[model samples]
Target: MAEALLTLAGVHTHIGQYHILQGVDLEVREGELTALLGRNGAGKTTTLRTIMGLWKASQGRLRFEGRDIAALATPEIARAGVAYVPESMAVFSDLTVRENLVLGARQGRLDSARLEWILGFLPALGKFWNHQAGNLSGGQKQMLAIARAIVEPRRLLLVDEPTKGLAPAIVQSLLAAFRELKATGTTILLVEQNVSFVKRLGDRVAVMDDGRIVHAGPMPDFAADRALQMRLLGLAMEAHT
Candidate 1:
């Protein structure tokens, strides 16, 4: 079997003695879209933050690309080929779309082919190349955040809540962009609250609750088991149907 692209074993974290992540374990295989699903405050976002070094793990092992990176700083982690797009869609509000893309390509020059490919997936961004990032709609900002991550040479992309507050039409567009990214060999670990959306794009689903993963399996498995959906996701088929 191939090695995991990212791994967390027995991870524990706390915020001033309040445990946020307790014995969390996860493995993200290369070139796969793995969705981390949970209700609010289930530690889904915290898992991504811990993996990216935003919050230090009090106890655990984190390995990325065959190297132990538990002790590395956030910037060092990013330099090692892991890119993160936070829930807020952290774009430079004053910077033009082109400038934001340029900043994301840390090696100084944007890969023209890669840039074009990303833009093709998000044609709205192409139309607003010279516009300030702040002026774009919420969905557009999310697209810009994702585009920036892929413009560089990233081995893995960790995205938190990519469809948080967008309309259905825009959300569909973002999902299509994710598919395009996967087609180009990008590994994605997405933390999402949108169950149907994740089910459509994810190869596997990891259900998180109270800072730990409770269930994980192929997407089809969860799709067929309505009991698993209600128990893990608190959703009935009737709610979605």
Candidate 2:
């Protein structure tokens, strides 16, 4: 309802000849955390890839900030203010944390004010500023990846599996950071399998299955709808409980 920051209409994507995305449509409102939820191989990652222009859509259009970016290159799209953090936590293994943060500053100008803002949300990153990303633990690497994305003046962030393979305590910390980031007016589109994480951070949720979004609604509504969750995500609340 708020001006759509990102929109995809009838998006179709293919990797080689394997048609992965088939007519997917999604809208991300400005300044909200929109979660893309699905079981494994539901094309959640591919949707993020398509939006970031890593996997060019074979058909359909992707508009960001009221501009058509379906044909732009990945770097061009990133320059347009969309940052992506892949599941791998794509941090520079060879670079020190400070050096990685420096590279993440989009304008090539580091603002102490912005740095302070990010550090406030991720105190662990502040402590590890001098450490190499490769040496950091899984949760630390995830934090660094997200901090790198936020260091820039970004309009939208596409994050894939930010809580993958981390301890529950670390996940809670990351979720708190996400809440802080959302409060700072950052628009986030996240792909996550963790239902609890989705329930906590998502203002809206979209369930992807077989390369398509099959269900979407407010997070509470989705969480309460046990049948939908069981059907789409193959998860039962009772089982998890």
Candidate 3:
């Protein structure tokens, strides 16, 4: 197994007096995809927010590559080579696709070779290069959001619900892009509701409920255990797959 690139130990978070995370613990292995799974309101999003420093961890530790980053600012965390793609597909609606990509470049300049590489995986972005992002379809906007995150190489990607609100064909295309990303040794921590998507792409899986992880194991082991899935997620994985 690859060494862990990110680790959360007994992490807790409170949002405006509501305790959203209750002693959560997780490990994202280097160069591997780890899926964070759960039902609605399961602290899955909160975990991601905490990791990105969008939400402060009220207690516990968050470590990336052996450095403590629990209390760092969001920009500081980004400077440390972590990128986050929120579930809302947070694209600049008024900006052109080209403009959005340019802003996503960390160093105030785009690398031509990297831009070409990203375009190869996400040709939709290329096709709509000059179009306003708001004019694009939901799937296209989602692709643009992802494309922006990867406009430059980074150590880790934290993505939330990449397949949300997309047609099956679009979902398949997005999955293919993610497969290419995985092939490049991009470490990812994905939060997803699609059982089949997680099953297909996740190397390891962690299930969360009520702000804490309820199960952690290999993806296949979790997928194959129908009873366990039902117990944790209140449904069978096979039904979704």
Candidate 4:
């Protein structure tokens, strides 16, 4: 078994008088893709945000490489080799694709070889390298957003709903990108509603509900049990695909 790259024990998060995460516990294994699955309003996004320190955890421990990170600021977490790709596809609309990636490099310089590597799979970004990001289509914007996150090496990636609203082809492209990233040993905790996507790529699975992780185990077992899926996710795994 691989060591856990990140771990959250009894995590709790509050959002302006609303308690979103209540005693959440999860572990993302090193060099494996862990899927965060759930119905709407299950606090999956809150789990990712809290791990990134975008929202403070009211209580519990968040550990990265056995080091406490519950109190680290967002930038501090980024500097510690953690990156987040939000569900909103938060690309810099005003900037060119090249410029947006340039900003994602924390070292203040873009590495040409690295940029070429990212462009290899996400070739859509290569097409609009000089064009404004705002002019790109939804799928293209999503590619740019993920490309930015990997412009530099990151130890852990927290992604939320990455396949939302994308075409089947675009979703396959994302699956390919994530597979390649995993080949390079990038540990990822992905929150996704695309059941097919998760079944294809996830090594470990965790199901979230009402601000808590209700069920977690190997992806194959979770994917095989339709009864469990319907009970926890409120939809049959087959229906979701």
Candidate 5:
């Protein structure tokens, strides 16, 4: 088995008055995609936020490359070779696509080769290279968000529902981009409800319910077992696009 690039052990999170995560544990192996699957309010987004230090983990540990990051700030986490793409597609609405990519490059400059590499798979970004992100369509903005995350090399990428509300055609484009990233050995922890997207891309799977992982293992095994899907997700994997 490949070594883990990121791990969360007994992680818990609280939001002012409520506990959002309770004893959550997850592992994202180097050079593979791990699908974090669950129904709404299962703390999938909270798990990503906790890992990125967007939300403090009230308990437990988060480690990246064997270093504790539960206490690290969000910018420090990014500096540590981790990038996050929220489900909201939080692009800089006021900035041009070029400026957004420049900001994403932590070293203060974009690598021409890497930019070309990203564009190779995500051509839409190149098409709207100078357009303000706010003016782009939903799918285009999603592409820009992903492009920004990969503008520089990263040890791990935490993405939330990249395909949500996207047209099937756009989803296919994202599927291709992720495939290229996988080929480059990028480790990814993806939180997604679109089982069809992950079914083709995920190497491992973890299902969360009630803020805890209730089932986890190889993606093929989980996807093949319809009963397991129904029991854990309360819906069929085939039911999602």
Candidate 6:
């Protein structure tokens, strides 16, 4: 078994007056894709933000590579080799694709080899290299967003809902790119609502609810149990798949 690259122990977070995360306990294994699954209002996004240091954890421990990082700032967390691909798609709409990717290089200089590799998997990024990010289609923009995150090497990627609001074909394209990325053995913690998508890519699974991870196990077992899915996700498995 691969050792956990990232671990959260009783993590709690507050946004304004709302207690978003009651207690989030999760382990992201090194070199494997772990799917963070939950129903709406399950605090999935908050967990990702807390890990990225975008939201300070009111209490608990967040450890990456075996060091305490619960109190680190966002930049420090990022510098520690943790990259976040937010659900908002956070692309600089006015900037060219090249320019946006240039910003993703944490050291202020793009690695040519890494850039070429990302472009090869996400060819749309190469095609729209000089175009304004806002001019690209939704799928293209998503590819660009992911491309930006990988402009440099990262040990762990916290990606939130990359398949949201995308057409089926575009989602498939994104899936292909992700599969190629998975081949590189970058550890990924993904938050997704699409059941089929998760079943296809996730090696391990964690289900979150009310800001806490309620279930954790291998993806195959989780996918095979329809009753478990209906209980945790509140939807019949057969109806969706």
Lowest lDDT sum, 10 consecutive residues, model 1, at 232-241
lDDT for each residue of candidate 4 in 1-241, tens digit (9 for 90 to 100): 9999999999999999999999999999999999999989999999999999999999999999999999999999999999999999899999999999999997899999998899999999998999999999998999998999999999998888888999999999999999999899999999999988999999999999999999999999998999998899877777757
Q: Which RMSD does model 3 reach against the true structure?
A: 0.8
Candidate 6 lDDT by residue in tens digits, 1-241: 9999999999999999999999889999999999999999899999999999999999999999999999899999999999899999999999999999999986888888888888877888888889999999888888888998888889999899999999998899888888988999999999999988988899999999999999999999998998999999987546666
What tens digits encode model 2's per-residue C-alpha lDDT throughout 44-158?
9999999999889999989999899999999999999999999999999999899899999867787899889888878888898888889999999999999899897799999
Candidate maximizing lDDT: 3
Identify the runs in model 3 with alpha carbons over 4 angstroms from their true place: none
Q: Write the per-residue lDDT of candidate 1 for residues 29-102, one digit (tens) a residue.
A: 89888999988999988899998999999999999998988899999999999999999999999999999999
Q: Between candidates 1 and 2, name the one with more favorable lDDT.
A: 1
Q: Which model is ahead, 1 or 5, in terms of lDDT?
A: 5
Global Cα lDDT for candidate 6: 0.92
Identify the runs in model 1 with alpha carbons over 4 angstroms from their true place.
Answer: none
Residues 1-241, candidate 5, lDDT per residue (tens digit)?
9999998999999999989899998989999999999999999999999998999999998999999999999999999999999999999999999999999987899999999999999998899999999999999999999999999999999999999999999999999999999999999999998998999999999999989999879999998899999999888778874
TM accuracy, model 2: 0.96
Model 3 per-residue lDDT at 23: 98
Candidate 5 regions off by >4 Å? none
**TM-scores of all models?**
0.96, 0.96, 0.98, 0.98, 0.98, 0.97
RMSD, candidate 5, Å: 0.9
- Name the candidate, 1 or 5, with the larger TM-score value: 5
Q: What lDDT score is found at residue 156 in candidate 4?
A: 94
Question: Per-residue alpha-carbon lDDT of model 3 for 1-241, expressed as tens digits?
Answer: 7999999999999999999999999999999999999999999999999999999999999999999999799999998999999999999999999999998997899899988888887889999999999999999999999999999998999999999989999999889999999999999999999989888999999999999998999999999999999999888888987
Report lDDT (Cα) of residue 126, candidate 6. Answer: 86
